[model samples]
Target: MTKITYVEPDGSRIEVEAENGSTVMENAIMNGVPGIVAECGGACTCATCHVYVDDAWTETVGGPSVMEEDMLDFAFDVRENSRLSCQIKVRDELDGLVVNVPTRQG
Candidate 1:
C-alpha cells in the first residue's frame, strides 16, 4: 500500500493507505475523505475529484493528458498542478504523495 495524504480546503490533512493500481480518488472515497465528490466514479469524465498536487510531487504525479485537460475546464480554480484524482494511480513510488482538495466541487 502507498501512503497518500489529502489536504482539505480548511488545511486539515487525511492520510490514507492507497492500494497499488487503484486510484487516488478511490482511496479518498474509501476513507470517506471529504472535499472530493467523485461524481463520475473514476471514469475521468468529471472534474469533481480535482486536486492540486503538491509542487514537490508534480513531476512524479505528472501533467494532465489532453482528455483530462479538456475535462479540467469545468473545475474550479484550476492550476498548473491541478489533476483529476481518478487519473492518478497509486504506486509504490508515490508512497508519500500529497494533494490538496479544493474548497468546492467543480
Candidate 2:
C-alpha cells in the first residue's frame, strides 16, 4: 500500500493507505475524507474529485488521461496542477504522493 496525503483547502490533512492500482479518489472517498465528492464514482466523468497535486509530486503522478482532462475543465478553481483524483491510480512508486483538495467541488 502507498501512503497518500491529502491536504484540504483549509490546510487540514487526511492521510490514507492507498492500495496499489486504486485511484486516489477511491482511497479518499472510501476513507470518508470530507473534501472529495466523487460524484461519478471512479468513472472520470465527474469533476467532483478534483485536486491539485503538489508541485513535487506532479511528475510522479504524471498528467491526466484525455477523458480526465476533459472533465477537469469543468472543475471549480482549476489550476495547472489540477487533476481528477479518480484518474490517478496509486502505485508503489507513489508511496509519498501528496495532493491538495480544492476549496470547492461540485
TM-score of 1: 0.98
Q: What do the candidate models score in CA lDDT, each in turn?
A: 0.94, 0.90
Going through the candidates in the order shown, the clash numbers are 0, 0
Give RMSD to native, each candidate: 0.6, 0.8
lDDT tens readout by residue for model 1, 1-106: 7999999988899999888999999999999999899999999898999999999999998899999999999999999999999999999889999999998978
After superposition, the stretches of candidate 2 with alpha carbons farther than 4 Å from their true spots are none
In terms of lDDT, which candidate is strongest? 1
- lDDT value for model 1: 0.94
How far does residue 77 in candidate 1 sit from its true spot (Å)? Answer: 0.5
In model 2, how large is the Cα lDDT of residue 6? 92
lDDT of 2: 0.90
lDDT of 2 at 52: 95
TM-score of each: 0.98, 0.96
Candidate 1 regions with alpha-carbon error over 4 angstroms: none
